[model samples]
Target: MPARILFIDDDPAGREVALFNLRKAGHEVTSAADGREGLAAFAAAPFDLVITDLKMPGIPGMEVLRKVRAHSPEVPVLVITAFGNVETAVAAMREGAYDFIGKPFHREQLLLSVGKALERRRLAAEVRDLRVRASGVGREIVCASDAMRRLLTIADRVAATDATVLITGESGTGKEVIARRIHVRSPRAEGPFVAVNCAAIPGELLESELFGHARGAFTGAVRDRAGRFRQASGGTLFLDEVAEIPAALQGKLLRALQEKTVDAVGADAPVPVDARIVAATNRDLPERIRAGAFREDLYYRLNVVDLHVPPLRERPADVAPLARRFISELAPGREIAVPPEVTAELERRPWPGNVRELRNACERMVVLCRGDAVSLEELPPLPRAAGERGGEEAQDWPPLPAEGFSLVDLEKRVIERALRLTGGNITQAAAYLRIPRHILVYRLEKYGIRRDG
Candidate 1:
């Protein structure tokens, strides 16, 4: 594809040079003299790439970066900065900048960064394609961790078919990532894989979102829309947190699933659809079905194949690799070498929040630590459940449940109490908890524990 380019800078000379080189490279180019104008230009059309100066009058390059991401998130962004302003470049990369070039940068480097960013976007799309094939019908895994492993095995088997698969897992166990992996392994490797979170959208408007609305469907429906089902046509429609879908809308969803057609909001007829379906949830759908909270027929239809992702605590062996992958992705600027002590701490600790907790820890260590090697002393401590971290006063509140009140909850409370005990000093809390500082911060968020801001 011939790429479109946006060049933004306050300096007229700089913008001209960028426009000249990019156009020479055969890309269609657009120029903006300032950040505000640059943003306006981007909003006006879809551009394949954007190269913006770090500093500009009015809105800065950072704000420009934010705007471009908001409008065209997948489009590549390259930052231009002065040689000594490496800090700004690093910040941009942390915020997902594809790459950067110093002020006196080589023409080769600029072109190379732009090319590589586009390639990365291409690769990400390709990966999504491949994952869909990998997880498609006839590829689902089968096992018997009683109800659990058996469920995953069923998913492994169903992944080979084109049936709609519903996956259930806790919040942080990576339910959707599993969905992508399934898609990559499935026959739909060549199709686009689109995902939407049901819980994130409002109950009142979710149907319109799933099914596109007409220009006058309702208030603020200014344009005719194509809902997710149509968008995922010939691909997979992944609905995360499927239980959050409203009861009233379940019948409509069922009709679409049964008939392979969707009637858009305010429209009179149903449009044909060719998308495969894969829904996920953190809630217990069977229980919901029993309680009449979720439609039984819809549950059966979606649960044609069910995959249950194992929690981090259940599979601690995978934590290190998962964490490393996340660290490499999230902390690309910081070449953080995981020290043995840090790795050991990561393993010894219980990750109630699973992969999400590990990612947060990596981000914290990258932000707080000064060097390439992450140290155990830099990790945060585990959280306290209920009132355990406070004192004997915790006992006065309530006895532990027969099943043992959630360790996740107690860990959060404990971390908070420790932070208070140490007066918000992370290092102090780490020492008191007898765990590495990085691990402590990970647990703090896992348990919803936060030091007083």
Candidate 2:
């Protein structure tokens, strides 16, 4: 429940009834005999939520809502109205009233309205917080592709609060890297970051690693020790491979997340700790949840913010820039040249490992191709997804893909090829396809094409 609710109504009976019901619902309630009193009360103290009747004397309900919205956009304003006041309620929404309850509303209706209103206010605050964090100092995850940019935009909003983040990508897709990005971009950046791999820790020791243990808690315990949560106090806790969390430990984990406190093994007291949670997993959590291996509630809590990193095969356009960037730093005398054909072949092959795989390719090229130039012969195995034009866009290719080839996997390969041919130039690719830059970008992102060198 919110800390306080202010009720405004001209009728003494209505005002008294609203105040009584709200107070009974466990809210600290204050009644206003009129809109003027409501506005005055609003000016004097902080209120989590405000409920006002539409037809009020002195200032009027609409005016009161306007002033409240202007002064405190984060606070929720709920308007109450008669049966035929639907139009007025619609206007109130435009004027920034969070929600409405009719005069003859049932007990649940009133309570639900207030609850939803408070929730809206909470979301607003969280969005604001995320905005601030998103603007924090760090090299932005730079990418010209619309999909990646869109994901980052969503990430900014997700980083604002303690909402659990679930980053999904194939192996080497940089999931953990993005998780750290969120952590550092969050308000809890100053807090310690403790990363736990559900897959790395032995199942038997998983619980101990997460929640800690009391002295003599187990045979191996020589002394009591603080756990990851305590270690990550006032910071963010990242759980990689979250889908691997065991069923037995899942319930305890859910409880700890809900309560923001942990009870170590063999300990009677629950120790409170403040830590923002950011969880990452490569597995399909929804599938795991359906298989009964993962708790549904815990999955929902952790999936509040989800980011899926497209495979290296999908974002081929990122390959070349990343590769050149990777190779340039390693190359002596400052400049390393990228051969167009090598990049073409790089774009042709499906990179199962995403960015991590591309980085390895660049490193290999740097080591093997000692000269400033790298050729297709020195590149890794290539895919035939690109080089299939003929105005068909996709079809007219040979039947039966070679070993490790998939028809369903052409998007990233083709986009990567187009980007490489276009010389890391987005406008050139759009021109080649005779499509708008935005549309081309959309296609590149949709296919997950990262340029390769």
Give the top-scoring candidate (TM-score): 2
Give the Cα error of residue 115 in candidate 1, in Å: 35
| Per-model lDDT | 0.76, 0.76
Taking every candidate in turn, the Cα RMSD to the unseen true structure, in Å, is: 19.9, 17.3
Q: Give the local distance difference test score of model 2.
A: 0.76
- For model 2, residues 1-453, the per-residue Cα lDDT tens digits are 546888888888767776777778899988888888899999998798888888876788999999998877678899989988899999999998888888867778888889888887788778765664664523335355666767777887777667888898766667777777787767676567788877656677889899999999989799998989889898888898788787999999998988999999999999998988888876778898888988999988777777998776766677667777778766767567898887777777676556656766776777788666887666655434455556564575434555766754664555666666544445445555665455655565566665441
* TM-score for each predicted model, relative to the true structure: 0.54, 0.55
Which parts of model 2 have CA positions greater than 4 angstroms off?
A: 1-142, 332-334, 382-453
As a TM-score, model 1 comes out at 0.54
| lDDT (Cα, tens digit) per residue for candidate 1, span 178-279 | 787666665565576889877656678889999898889899989999999999887788998788788999999999999999999999889999999999
Evaluated at residue 293, the lDDT of candidate 1 is 92
RMSD over all Cα atoms, model 2: 17.3
